[model samples]
Target: MTERPSLKEMRAKALKNPEVKAEYDALASAFEMKRQMIALRKAAGLTQEEMAEKLGTKRSNISRLESMSASNSPSIATIENYARVLGYSLRVGFEPAAAR
Candidate 1:
C-alpha cells in the first residue's frame, strides 16, 4: 500500500505551484482590505453590528470582515455601496513610494 505524503511535504509542494502563489497574493489583499475596512468603521465610531446593518448586511458579516477574512471579498460595487451607507467617499488612486 502507498503511504500519504506528510504535512510538511504537502506544504512544500503547494508553495512551489504558481497557482498557489497567486491565491496567496489574493488572500493577502483580502486581509489588507479587511483591516482597512475595520479601521474605517472604528474611526466612524460605528459598531460592527451597526455598520453591518447600515451596510444592509448581517452583524456576522461585519464581524467576519473586521476579523481579516470576511468573504472572498465583496465586489467593488459592494464596497462602494458600503462607503455610501457609511456617508464616506470612496476614492481610488495609485502613487508610487518615494525613492530611498
Candidate 2:
C-alpha cells in the first residue's frame, strides 16, 4: 500500500506555483467566513433544515450559502437575513491586503 501525501504537504506543493498561491491566498478569507457561519449555526444548535425553516428558505439554499463557490457571492441582504435568524448580526470591514 502507498501512503497518500498529507494536506499540508499537498498545500505546500500547490503554493509553489505563483498563480495557485495567489488564488489560494485570495480564497482564504472566504473559506474562513463559511467556517465561521457553520460554527455559529452549530453553536446555536440549528441544523440546515431548522435554520432554513427559520429563514423561510430551503435547506439546500442554506447548504449552498454555507458552501458557496468562488463565483457565487451571497448578497448583503441575504447574509443579514441569515444573521437575523441565527440571533446574530452581520458586520463588514476591510483589512490591509497581504504582501505578495
Candidate 3:
C-alpha cells in the first residue's frame, strides 16, 4: 500500500480544475466565517455545547451552523446573536462583484 497524498497536495490538485476552483472560490467566505467562529469559541474557552447553552440553542444546532453549506444562508439576527454571545459584534459589508 502507498501513503495517501497530504491534504495540501490534494487541494492543490483539485484547485487546478477550473470548475472546482470556481466552486471553492464561491464558498471561500463561508469557509472563512466558519473558521473564525470556531476560533472565537476556542479563544473564549467554550465548547460547542457551552456556546449553545449561552446562545439558548442545542449543541447539534451549533454543529450544523458551523458546518453549514454555502447555499444555506444564516440570518443576520442569528449571526448577531452568536457574535454577542462570543463577546464580539457582527458587521456586514459588500464588495464590488468580480468582472465576468
**Local distance difference test scores for all models:** 0.74, 0.90, 0.88
Candidate with maximal lDDT: 2
The runs of at least 3 residues in candidate 1 whose Cα sits more than 4 Å from the true structure, single-residue gaps closed, are 1-26, 92-100
Clashes of 1: 0
lDDT of 2 by residue, 1-100 (tens): 9999999999899999999989988888889889989999999999999999999999989999999474589999998888888888999999998776
- Candidate 3: misplaced stretches above 4 Å? 69-71
Higher-ranked by lDDT: 2 or 3: 2
* TM-score list, all predictions: 0.54, 0.89, 0.90
User: Which pairs of residues clash in candidate 2, taking residues 3 or more apart in a chain or in different chains?
Assistant: none
Which structure is stronger by TM-score: 1 or 3? 3
Q: Over 4 Å off in model 2, which ranges?
A: none
lDDT by residue (1-98, candidate 1, tens digit) is: 99999998997899899899677665765577667777778888999888887878899876765665343656677778767776766776665643
Question: Alpha-carbon error at 52 in model 1, in Å?
Answer: 1.9
Task: Check candidate 1 and list the clashing pairs.
Answer: none
Error of 1 at 58 (Å): 1.6
Q: Which 10 residues in a row give candidate 3 its minimum summed lDDT?
A: 65-74
| lDDT for predicted candidate 1 compared with the true structure | 0.74
